[model samples]
Target: MEYLSNWAKNIVYYILFVKLISHLIPSGNMSKYIKLFTGVILIIVVMEPILSLPNMEQKIKSNILNMENIIAHKDFQSQSKTYSKVNDQLAINLYKKQVEEHIRKLVRGEDVEVSSINIKINEEEGKNFGEVVSIDMKVRKKNSSNDLSIEKIKIGADSTAYNITAEDIIIVKNIKIALRGFYNISPDNMNISVSQ
Candidate 1:
């Protein structure tokens, strides 16, 4: 728009200059030549603005390209943030599933049916195994012979299912000793429960 206004101003200036020169020239063939020369100058004045367009276009194009680059960078950053959140959630879910699987293996080859496993994790600490806050397990047996339910309740005995009893426990001097270990927390910080 500025270029257009400048072009108009240049045209007005050239017209005034040509008019002033016309008055100074004498009436003869030389005057005709002067008039013709002024006409050529008028043509040059009209075309000057149009000829300088490529340089102006280059600057405008450069600004447009810069804006596009900025928009692309911002879009990438937004996508990365979204993906990071999704990835974190997926990691937590996968870890929980793995823990459930490990508990199932603890039952070994038996008739016990695991109902559900609920574990509450600390989101602030991320999905690290040490960040586990609590775990609740529900399980039952199909039959007495294929189960260790009654043995688990026996007054002074460790029970077995499928001839299996895997542990490091010792009940001596009326002080029941069990080795229950977990990461990222002290013994007092962990909460665990199992029910049949």
Candidate 2:
């Protein structure tokens, strides 16, 4: 790999140098120099990756084929629609589990029983395309002993599936602090204080 990378670097340097000299020697210096330099830089930028891609692609293809063979040998197969449905459910479940764990840690209580947790997949009215799946959750937690309302928490977890498995198929992309309040809880929507 090192040898190949060195070889590619040297070839690119030589090509750019030759192009630079050829441009400097001809066509009145200034305009040609600018055009040739820009062109040479763009070519190097694009072609360097192209030149280095074959080795990486070969490794990826080999690994994928090996994985496929292993799965086939293990007699594992699912229809495309079924696989997608399973994946979506897995993603939602993963988000719920994470939220439960996080709330348990954050809230000061022993019997930290979480009430209903809802997850919604919002892909509309935004520019979140081909990136992370944004998940909105409405959660309720009780201070088990006193039974006091730990004001209904509204949070969001962002995730994307990568290496999906048979059982737990979703992978976490990122989870951020979205909103914290009791506004999501009441019939009349009374105000509540949110502390950091």
Candidate 3:
């Protein structure tokens, strides 16, 4: 608006002012100097609006701030999602560990060491929950017990089932039974294995 006002006034006075100045000037050697000075002043007046425009530095700074805010917001969302996934996995792992520890605690007589326990879980409708599909373990007897051995006991129709002792598998089956009873899980859906 300021530049527009200045421009309007300049144009309105341009012809009248130039004519008046021309008439008053001593029409001699001095006229050239006066004409030259007036021309220079006219040029300055026309260019003032362009010179007063906003600088590029301020625009660049504003753009940079906007870009920074966008990046920060995106990074925060990505990190939050990653953290949630990790937390869910951690919860599942802790549950599996607790189950293994509980089974280890239940074994009676002749030191029983449980190596590892795994449970398969499933997710549905934005909610996650699953039953133990199968369990595998490495069992070893710490002391020389002459009365009891794992291989002699029978488990199933499969000949390989006997390859791994019955005692170790029976202990695991008991653990599974306890789990099924406690959690109310169907036995048909679960597979239990114990090896020495």
lDDT of each: 0.60, 0.46, 0.66
Measure candidate 3: CA RMSD: 4.8
Q: Summarize candidate 3's per-residue lDDT along 1-196 as a digit string, tens digits.
A: 7758977788667767878888887689988897898788778778766665565457778999999999999999999999989887888788777766765665433355656555555533243364454555455555555675334655568755565565665666676677677556566655555444
lDDT of 2 by residue, 72-139 (tens): 76664456667877887777667556754554353323222333333333333356422223223332
- Ten contiguous residues minimizing lDDT sum, candidate 3: 123-132
The residue pairs that clash in candidate 1, if any, are none
Write down the TM-score of every candidate.
0.54, 0.25, 0.61
As for candidate 2, its clashing pairs are: none
Relative to the true structure, candidate 2 reaches a TM of: 0.25
Clashes of each: 0, 0, 3
Candidate number with greatest TM-score: 3
Q: Which candidate is the best by lDDT?
A: 3
TM-score comparison, 2 vs 3, better candidate: 3
Native-to-model Cα distance after best TM-score fit, residue 44 in candidate 2, in Å = 3.7
**Candidate 2 lDDT trough over 10 residues, lowest sum:** 167-176
